[model samples]
Target: MKKEKLLMTPGPTMVPPAVLMAGGEPMIHHRTPEYSQLFRELNKNLKTIFQTQNPVLTFPAAGTGGLEAAVVNFFSPGDRVLCTSIGVFGDRVATIAKAFGLNVEKLTVPLGEAVDPRIIEEKLKEQNYKGVFVTHNETSTGAYNDIEAIGKITKNKDILLIVDAVSSLGGLDLKTDEWGVDVVITASQKALMAPPGLTFLSVSNKGWEAAQNSTSPKFYWDVIKARKAMEKPSPQNPYTPAVSLLRSVNKALELIIEEGLQEVFHRHSQLAKATRAAVEALGLKLFAAPQARSNVITSIKMPEGIDGEKVKKQMAEKYGVITAGGQEDLKGKILRIGHMGYVHEGDIIQTIAALEKALIDVGYPIEKAVGIKAALEVFN
Candidate 1:
């Protein structure tokens, strides 16, 4: 029998039917009035998703490229920037800054733990930093940092707060304007429930001011040029845009708004809660602490004798439950399950059941249906 395929990874999550169909439609010419209307509306609607009044720039790039744009467009070379990291993606920010010839300082916590905002405050007090980079939700370790607190610390200062929200943008309660996030980076996939190809980011007034003062060399990744193009009466991209992907993102954003922002966030919260409950019920420990847990993806620590990679493979190849294994040193030590974007309660139920079956198949001792029962209780 052929098993059903499920996408349980943190990114490239399951796409909705409406969004898929939008991508299938015939491509519209970028210069047409119809496309210009769409291009402009997309910019406005993205502000709603980001909870910001600033223009949300759309680029034909991945989240990483958006991250790079945030760096090059806002800071000059040799500027002091602090990159606070809790996992792989956070570390990537420092690397990108170094590549741009910026003086990078990293405040990294242990894997599976969130970076403390107080520590960030202490570090800022000791040095004059041009900007502070932090991950809203660490994709690798499933840890959610306290960006709001960090934002509060950097708000009164001249420091710019840049957040990586690739995984948490739509699924989590990230208040971009209210939280004072100067710049936020996200992608079309992940919680946006659209296909990979487009990157979206918002910049506040402070972020724009920094960009004006920035002497960084930028051409294609130039936010100033992108914003100027958008400011025209008929909006257009400076380069040929990904028309189909942006079309898909329009439908996805509609779905998100129709569900209501608070409702969407609540759904992710419930799903994450159910997943954590199931993991604990199955006698497996979660890699992230409760206070630092991410609603987008849940990382579970592997049992002492079980191979996390093997379990991930069995869940996919044998049971049709696609899951992600840990990265780097944590590889073979943890397994991650995504609960973001277009996921329902039934998906959670089925995922927990599949996880149980995979565990038993991997020689891990577990009582049948215990995990599912706990998960159901949480959902109920």
Candidate 2:
């Protein structure tokens, strides 16, 4: 029988063997001492990883849940919030704010680019917005925004800074408190190296203050409640947590700690560079601008006559290499190559080779050996 294929998508990335094993461990009652220890350690380590002195809350939900929590628990009806929409995830921020009844002023830039800080500052000057929402890394177009610059721009405005760092968290350097971000949201599957189903958030004093006055109907995503429970001597949660997922997260965090954050960031940067080199060597164009490209996922424009979906399908079916096509309007226009989490040099080479073959099989004019050779040059 053929071995199972490797995943190279943006989220739900390949999990390390230790994390997979931890997830298979027998479940324990969430209220028991064993679970209490696990919860305590998870909470503590998440703070360290987030680089925040404040408490970081964990929920047994997806990254969307964390985004919802940030929206619902921080703002109320009729509140004005400024959001930047340069790609898919950035648009999600605007959408979530609208769904929560906030007056969303969306500042949009072209796809494959980042919103300008000058524009954000200009917008802040025009209106007294309650909060500013930005996605640190826009996964769809592989564009990475400079949250620190945005954070500084909002500092004097007295507006709250909420950042979506779901795909960028461990892959890039995101200093939460130091950057003056009031709320930093992340998920398990991206750069965190854990499986999906768990979302994490770090809330500063300013964010907690906003929560105290917010009138949104939120019981599950309440930061105050989660923080209160976490501070208790015996760990407890307001609901039945995802016990196995949390265990996996704990093990994942251990690997992160042992490898060190700087090393993790460097690894992702190297992989991203190698992937970009491969794309250029194949005579392909990258979707995102060089300055705004993300280290986790690389989006490449499809050759004029090649179908992006066909490339994804053929790569998976013939080479056992799983990749993703573009989202929404970008469908059949570009291909997304994810290099975050457990992806390594070998995985990168295999993906480049498979992509070369897929392009050739689909009648595109790619030289069969170009991509792999370029990738090997970077890896060596």
Q: Show model 1 residue runs off by greater than 4 Å.
A: 1-4
Q: How well is each residue in 246-350 modelled by candidate 1, as lDDT tens digits? A: 999999999999999999999999999999999999999999977999998999999899999999999898778788999999999999999999898988888
Q: What is the lDDT of residue 311 in candidate 1?
A: 93
TM-score of 2: 0.98
- Candidate 2 lDDT by residue in tens digits, 1-380: 99779799888889999999999998799888999999989988898789899898899899999999999999998899998888888889899889989999999998899988999988888889999999998889989999889988976566899999998888889999888999999999988889999999999888898999999889899888988888889978888889999999889888988899898888898899999999999999999988999899999999887899999999999999898999999999999998888889999998998999999899988778798888888878
Q: Give the residue spans of candidate 2 off by over 4 A.
A: none
Best by TM-score: 1
257 Cα displacement, candidate 1 (Å): 0.3
